[model samples]
Target: MKSKAAIMKTSGKIELGRRRAVWELPAELANLHHKVSIGSSCFLKLAPRPSKHWDARRAAELAVGAGFTLDKPCFFRSQIAFLSVTKIESLPDSVGPKMQTLMVGLNPSPYSSASRVPYGRPGNRFWPAAHRAGLISKDRDIHHALVHHGIGFTDLVRRTTRRAGEIDPPEFRSGFERVKSLIEWLKPKVVCFVGLSGWRIVSNPKAKAGIQPASIGLTTVYVMPHPSGLNAHASLKDLIGH
Candidate 1:
């Protein structure tokens, strides 16, 4: 016996089998057959013919509509559109007491939100610079840094966006309050901001890279150029030096 293929309607809702699990799709993406599965992580598999319409941005929007966040979209060996998703809308702060340094970013991108690792995006130079700077023994391992190196990760804003420019000034101010509270409680020796933009908006509009004069509670603040590949002002060596 063969089970009939599930159908998605223009309303972007579909019920699956007896489990009755529902997924919301965009109108343009409707009528596609999707397979939803859960493992150590959750994945939404969409089987649509290869078309110019399907891209990473559209996939991200679809995932957001369904109350999920996605990593970089990929294709399975079978050429199916594979999207790994997290139910949470934003990346959670990875922090602990007895921290040497706390690294903060402006916000989460879809890449990091899905992987549950800050700066997990491939083109992002954060991990490489961290490794070169002797901050972490292993690359791209947040747990390793937290557990072994006494380094913690967090973000100024909990929102996830494709670009940091998409975040507004109000979010930065509110997020600074949250980060300030966290620092006062944890009292890390140093608080390192991966980008100057967020700190500049919230604390010092004219702030340049390196240690800032103001302290968040008793913690010293250090600002570094964003390690995003798109940020060409700083080179890999410059980031390592920071």
Candidate 2:
């Protein structure tokens, strides 16, 4: 008989394969030869295919009209496609328009994608630090707890990549508009970016990385060390400046 570990391994492999398949959708989008743009720095140039349906054209138009242009290759230099049709379950509840603090990260980890939970990564210290920093009351149901505290979590770029280095600066700039919209709606008083790398992506010429006490777009923007295990210096003290 197969061991329990063997069964678990097979399940894990199957799941990984499924996710890998989803990540490949860009290829299909490219096959349509639809010019598309993602964020501000990327573009796709292609002759519209005869077999393409109207909706594909419409999606392409939306892509181009939203600063996604077939006219240039300034953004996403390697590829271009319409935003993925994210499943409804992929998003959290609509955060209210009165947030006190907001936390932003570079992107979601594969574990977060798998669990459909924000900051769900086990290697990410966001939860523990927030809890200990008095951002949350214990670890009980962190999502609900955060909402209760007028706190919310989001990313600089909503797109998920295997690693943070895969992101482009233009994408962060493009996402800034969306971030502003969130802040306007949520009215968060403090906006904390996850790490130095993230701060640099959206930084002005004068601001430095590490802990910062600054403001951007009607919200106070604070720079904190990333909670990823990769950031060895990202202790609770390092982030909170204690």
Candidate 3:
């Protein structure tokens, strides 16, 4: 990870704590992966009908609960309510005490959740940049990078969100508790926060990008810019440099 600390998937084997699972992506599921991993931020919002339906009044109330403003006439005219925040299945974290570095993100983007892979979103710069930086082979088999290369993955929050901006305060607080416990348990050599905002929220408010005087049990902590394309301050090369 760049910036001293930072943060999918390929088919091979995944190591979670002491357990190892055979990892493979079936070809048939590629369409769904493409939709969520590519379409979430750019377009294709969660629709209301498939999971839950809001009959006018309930939709408005729930929208407000999710922090959406109903004051605008143009807001959320589609059939789907954005309330499907929780994923059917949370992405599995790949972690172990023997790892050289543990990369942590703020949470799952809807795309990442759908694909069951960290930073699986096509819009994210993480995978490509890591390859460019020589952190991974050009083929970028994530399973090899983690199982054989001593890299691991995790998230500050377990929930999925269409946008990081939608995360409520309670979610962050609970997520932080879980993160601390994970760090204490694994004690990876380095714990890198993929986004500075995540570090700021759950960690020292004054901490900036790069190594910090933070530790969980024996693990060192650092912060870096998120590899999202939306973060303009850090480019692909810059991320590699970090």
For residue 224, what is the lDDT in candidate 1?
Answer: 97
lDDT, candidate 1, 49-101, per-residue tens? 55444444444444443334555564444434456665555665656667899
What lDDT would each prediction earn against the true structure? 0.68, 0.50, 0.56
Backbone clash total for model 3 is 6
lDDT per residue as tens, model 3, 1-242 = 11111001213311111111111111111222232332222111322232232233333332222212233322344443222222133454655446778888887776775555678787788888877877667343545677676677777665577887788766776667766765665577888899888888876778888889877788888788899988899988889887
The most accurate candidate by TM-score is 1
- Which digits, one per residue and each the tens of the lDDT, describe model 2 over residues 1-242? 00111111232221011122221222233222122222323322322222222133333433322222344322221222223221211212223345787777776666664454556777767777777778877553534655578776667665567788897888887766666655654567888777667777676545565446556657777777677777776665665552
Q: Model 2, stretches more than 4 Å misplaced?
A: 1-94, 138-142, 209-214, 240-242
Residue 221 lDDT (model 1) = 95
Residue 34 lDDT in candidate 1: 22
The residue pairs that clash in candidate 3, if any, are: 2-242, 3-242, 47-80, 48-79, 48-80, 48-81
Q: Would you give me the overall lDDT of model 2?
A: 0.50
TM-score of structure candidate 1: 0.65
Superposition error at 209 for model 2 (Å) = 5.1
Better of 1 and 3 by lDDT: 1
Each candidate's number of clashing pairs is: 0, 7, 6
Model 1 stretches with alpha carbons more than 4 Å out: 1-87
Model 2: residue 4 alpha-carbon error in angstroms: 37
